[model samples]
Target: MSIKNKVISTLALSGAVLAFSAAVSAQDATPSTMEKTEKVPKRGGHGDKHKMGGRRGMMHGIELSEAQKTQLKAIHEANKPSESAMSEMRELRMAKRAGTLTADQQTRFAAIKAERKSKHAAVKAQIDSILTADQKQQIETRKVEMKQKMQERRELRKQRKANQTETAKPVAG
Candidate 1:
């Protein structure tokens, strides 16, 4: 009933909303098989070995020249961190989820994630540098289109979940 308690509750609700939205819209590190079903020639759709897209896989319909592909692949390989580093990041995430990570571990994990993000950005920038003006437009258009598609999918999933919960109720005797 106090102002302090009301503020705490409001903060908690906002945090939950943000967390749910993030989980719903987070892009995949690797696109699933379903996403890779259709192959677009020249245009890097989903399964790009070169990692042309950023961490969120934004390189949807942007066509890449063979030379550009080679360059992007080289940049991607060079920017990749050690296997141990990635494994440690995974462990840190698990610790956080388990509510067992110490303050020091949280700091360390934040540093690791930031470093990873920077490396990803560097690779993406390298790829973007070689793209022509038209290519850049394609990338931007595809990103917007994909974002809308993702939002639609999330809405459908929520509706389906609600329906299932409703159907699970026992009928009146």
Candidate 2:
């Protein structure tokens, strides 16, 4: 081929290769939106049920007695907030997220969150009181595993963001 024709052909081939590689790399580099959506548990779904089951449920999975189940369920029920307070907290969170909350409202929201967290900790302590040393150890192990998994997830998200930012920059000649 003539020199000019050879250069043109080479450029065309390079462009085609870049496009093909981008298409393939895109598929491998990013997770599908559906996959991301599936990773999030549905509200009031199995996740909620598991959380509601609390330490008792976790122990049950490891084979706690019927009496233990009854005790655990009682603990969970007793610790559950009154419906009105739960509703108010939900409303407050929604309002805050919507950017409709004022400074005073934010203060109240912080107080509510603190109160809920304290109550949750108290309930957890009560549940722990019922657990044997082995069961408590098991729960602690599970908590550590969960923390590790969460850390891994955060790192993955950070890496993904960095990759996205790098890819978005314009390539220089």
Candidate 3:
């Protein structure tokens, strides 16, 4: 082959090789066509509690009677904050986020929060009254177990982070 032909052939081969590599890299960077879409749970949403079997699940396990369930539901509904209150809370949250809450609004917001907390405590006490001693004991046991599991997860995360940091550190020559 002529020197010009050899050079042209070599250039074409290098171009093909580079194109192949680029295609592979692009494929690796992009998600696959069959990849499942991840559903991110909304923060502070009602559905979040029951997904992992929260308080309701614990109560269910305790086998509360129909009357108890009905009473609990009624208590929840009766104590539920009004739409106007929710809207006000939302507005206050927005104002707080924007750093624009006035002194009066701040005081009002704190009062609203305190009122909500009291209402929650009251509902909880009412619910406890309905629950049997055995049921409450079971619920407490579950809570303790859950707390321990959470602590274990936290320790594992810390250990993983420490391992990552150690691995990331450069070795001195």
Candidate 4:
């Protein structure tokens, strides 16, 4: 190949490799706490507790009045069905992992998951509507900071895993 052709080919190959790595990294990225909380089972079988803590913390930070807490609790209670559905989905997932779920069971479980996700979004929107613009901004800012911290923690965990894996190799004789 001519020098120019070789250069072009090298650049094209580098671009493709970069694109592939970016896609793979995106797939490997850890889910945010919010996403995990909304999807996964929490420790002690009460995943919603973390979410409730988050809400209460936000309320305290924003200095929500007693009336506001009452209103917020009402909204939360109204959204309890979605939380229950999520718990049910988690149980179904655990059953599937245990290899006891039938195909029909899996299908029903998936449908419930989808429904719960939609309802959860609706509940979030309702809650957001209750907040003032300043409160909304504070919530968004806190969320971003929390996500960044979680990502950093996940990176640390990954580094620890890598170190453990490297240490586990037996030395060659």
Candidate 5:
């Protein structure tokens, strides 16, 4: 094969590897989930300092008093998964990635997910109680704005895909 062909093959393989890793890690980095079930980057590592899980993300753009901040921090700390649980979750994620998760491990993973869901809900309630009515309204408005932005992005992606499909068509000479 020519050198050009070999370089193309290498680039293709690298793209595939990156795509696969991103797909596998997507769930581990769910923006909506409070508990980090897997060992991923910190919540604000991507320049989204406020777009964290739990109440922090939901309360984005809403001002909080010093007391409220302290309370929410305490709630977060109190509800964090134990170190053992985090370790088990990391192991399970690895097994899942390797396609070696057994039926028992699947069951365990499901239980852990459920526990995290409940804990997230409980923490959200506590945070809600701390917020004033006006702050809640601000949060709701932000949510609506974000939803609109997401919808626009989806439409844009669809249009881009359509254009690509059109451009890829073969023209008769």
Candidate 6:
């Protein structure tokens, strides 16, 4: 997991998914509050994808050449699914969390994931075509660095969660 991957995963979990569910659950509340809570933030665009070669926050101090930046932008655009597919994915994710999915829904969701995975693989191939041999090797090294960072974050989160539970408990003495 690169830093970009980590950020995307975190945002999907804490931002988009949570916001939608929160809005839906609060539907019966006051109209003004509901309206404010229901607005879903727009997804990232050219700025997010092309800015710093999609590793804006992740790869500190490393900069891509003009050619590399252009190729990365093209690769990102090519890999992005259609708007309809993204909407369907969002709906399926919300439904999965809201309740048990029927057999058909489960099958459809699985197919969508497969399609997205295929697109990702194609994009990766395109990116590799643009990179120099040394850059490709550097990416592999970065993957290892990212994996270690991810594990450390997970452990830290677990410890924080445990401490919260302990503090919340009342002493029996």
Estimate candidate 4's alpha-carbon lDDT, on a 0 to 1 scale. 0.80
Using lDDT as the measure, what is the rank order of every candidate, best first? Answer: 3, 5, 1, 2, 4, 6
State TM-scores per candidate.
0.63, 0.63, 0.63, 0.60, 0.64, 0.61
**Candidate 3: which pairs clash?**
none
Question: 66, model 2: CA deviation in Å?
Answer: 1.7
TM-score quality measure for candidate 5: 0.64
Clash pairs detected, candidate 2: none
124-158 per-residue lDDT for model 3 (tens digits): 89988999999899989988888998899999999
List per-prediction Cα lDDT, in the order shown.
0.83, 0.81, 0.86, 0.80, 0.85, 0.79
Query: Using TM-score as the measure, what is the rank order of every candidate, best first?
Result: 5, 3, 1, 2, 6, 4
lDDT of 6 by residue, 1-173 (tens): 89999998998888888899999998875568768889676776445554534554333344568888787777776666789988988998988999977889999999998987887788778878887777777777787888999999999999999999999999999
- What is the lDDT for 87 in model 5? 99
Q: Which parts of model 6 have CA positions greater than 4 angstroms off?
A: 1-53, 57-62
Residue range with the least summed lDDT across 10 consecutive positions in model 3:
48-57
RMSD of 5: 16.2
Worst 10 residues of 6 by lDDT: 52-61
Instruction: Using lDDT, give the best candidate's number.
Output: 3
Residue 55 of model 4 has an lDDT of: 40
Candidate 1 all-Cα RMSD: 24.2
**Tens digit of lDDT per residue, candidate 2, span 1-173?**
89999999999999999999999987867778898778675576654446655544445355567776688889988887898988888988899889999888899889988998999899889878877888888877777877898899999999999999999999999
Q: Largest TM-score belongs to which candidate?
A: 5
TM-score of 1: 0.63
lDDT for position 157 in model 1: 100
Candidate 3 versus the native: TM-score? 0.63
Pick the winner on lDDT between candidates 3 and 5. Answer: 3
